[model samples]
Target: MKRDPPPPPPQPFFFFWGPPTPRGRGGGGGGGEKKKNFFCFFFFFFFFFFFFIWKRRGPPPFFFFGARTRTPPSPPPAPAS
Candidate 1:
């Protein structure tokens, strides 16, 4: 007697853009994974970039805690004549 082949795996739910591709030795669905990785990298790059700017330059003037009036430095008194 002969046995039947196993059923294919269920489709993953996260992919909304298109139908699932057939899995094979060449690695199906690799393109979607690259897109996801790119998005993740982009988000983290901006996150760290803004965080670095904030650390180096402090908060923007519009922020409540950063809002402060500027004052000119006072002139030094003249030396005794």
Candidate 2:
């Protein structure tokens, strides 16, 4: 009896699976970048805002840690006769 032709060899893994996916790279990381940039922008904006107010007005009465340490100014000296 005649023998049947052997089956063809299996195809390469990539041929079925398609190109390999990039690892740890692409749109997934965009959110973190945006968050980081937002935080940075917020920090700088508040820093400059407070700095401007400080220049215009002066140091605030209190600080995060505690109240201001400066003592009240003494009254002006009495006028000489």
Candidate 3:
């Protein structure tokens, strides 16, 4: 005999509340395959930095690690006699 149609998929426990957010609880795909906030932040920072370096010859001397070179101040003018 022909079998009846399979049962419908199970409804989400809290699906009635909202569609679903990326921040949903575990197993919610929150940590399954999606990227974390830290990664996104890092990605954006590097992306912006890449564009900034391209736009402006490289990061300012201050943003570098280790001691950086400082701009030399103008020499004092010679005293008038």
Q: Which residues of candidate 3, in runs, are more than 4 Å off?
A: 1-35, 58-81
1-81: candidate 1 lDDT, tens digit per residue: 986555344445544333544432112343556656777899999889878988999765765764564778999999999
Q: What is the C-alpha lDDT of each candidate?
A: 0.60, 0.55, 0.56
The numbered model that scores best in lDDT is 1
lDDT over C-alpha atoms for residue 38 of model 1: 70
Off by over 4 Å in 1: 1-30, 62-81
- Residue 37, candidate 3: alpha-carbon lDDT: 59
Model 3 C-alpha lDDT per residue in residues 1-81, reported as the tens digit of each score: 997555334335633232344544323334322434555778999999888886888555665763567668999999999
* Model 3 pairs whose backbones collide: none
Q: Where is model 1 poorest over a 10-residue stretch in terms of lDDT?
A: 21-30
Q: In angstroms, give how far residue 41 of model 3 lies from its true place.
A: 0.2
Off by over 4 Å in 2: 1-30, 64-81
Model 2 residue 53 CA deviation (Å) reads 0.5
| Per-residue lDDT of 73 in model 3 | 98
